[model samples]
Target: MKRTPFGAWPCSIARAVDLLGDWWTPLVLREAVFGVRRFEEFQRHLGIGRNVLAQRLNRLVDEGLMDRVPYQDRPLRHEYVLTDKGRDFFPVLAAIIAWGDTWLSDDEGAPVVLRHRTCGHETRAVVACAECGDPLRIEDMEALAGPGLRTAGTAGTARTAGTAEGEPTAAAADSP
Candidate 1:
């Protein structure tokens, strides 16, 4: 569960994958975000085993992406709701939907459309800079080492920029 270093090649992808990469995890989050709060509801919608659904929900709560609320007094039934961090994943889910609509849709149009309540218009997910309102592309961003950086020599040759084979760049100190 340890996080790999930033600025490392594929580090962002790896961290994201580590956090919510599994086949069931995103679906669980999808259900939670979409208001499928009850355990039975998730089980029915996903057709996942009760035990697997239980584990995914527990993991989300442990990770602080979800809050468990009491739904029934007797025997304490509960429903899971998204935390702020979980809500922040809306863009990620939208992107996933976009990707599916592009590559997996049977028809040219999307299977399910997301409409803005205020505008009454269907919208697509966009990645944009908050300050500039500029759309972000892969090449528009740069990843820098954060508070986790360590000296390249001491950390590993994985950080040597000119390392002969299978080495990480100098900018990527903690990449292994």
Candidate 2:
């Protein structure tokens, strides 16, 4: 079946999900963040099929989240390195890890713990308001219309009406 593209959606979340929502992409990114640079290494770490690994790497490169750098001249082998945009995605991965460790871990506890090298302390990721430096909780947050928002009959609105249930309403999905 053909996949419905979400890249052009007005919602930043939707666009991000479009790029990274697949099961393998985030794992590949996690490996990259953990210093897995080579194709063989990613495959071995992920236990993913070679073809799928290649596809995910290519997609990440195309999306500007990763840079494919030539490492070997003889056979032209390349290494995948995270770009600035990809590095910026680290917090998202941290949040995912935090959630998993909290909700899904066994009684033995989280298999991994993130420690800060500079502070020499273990840390957990938390979302905070940029302006106030206060932790942001879902109940404390409110959505407001932004500059890129569009109403019905407005020009440059890319989304169509009648999206499936559980999807963001058009008015709530403002372009970024």
Give the TM-scores of the predictions, in the order they appear: 0.75, 0.84
Q: Whole-model lDDT, candidate 1?
A: 0.79
Candidate 2 lDDT tens digits, 88-132: 999999999999999999999998899989999999899999999
RMSD (Cα, Å) for all candidates, in order, is: 6.9, 6.6
Q: For model 1, state the Cα shift of residue 90 in Å.
A: 1.2
User: How many backbone overlaps does candidate 1 show?
Assistant: 0
The CA lDDT of each predicted structure is 0.79, 0.87
Q: Where does candidate 2 have its weakest 10-residue lDDT segment?
A: 152-161
Candidate 1: deviation at residue 94, Å? 0.6
Kindly report which residue pairs in candidate 2 clash with one another.
none
| Model 2: per-residue Cα lDDT at residue 175 | 44
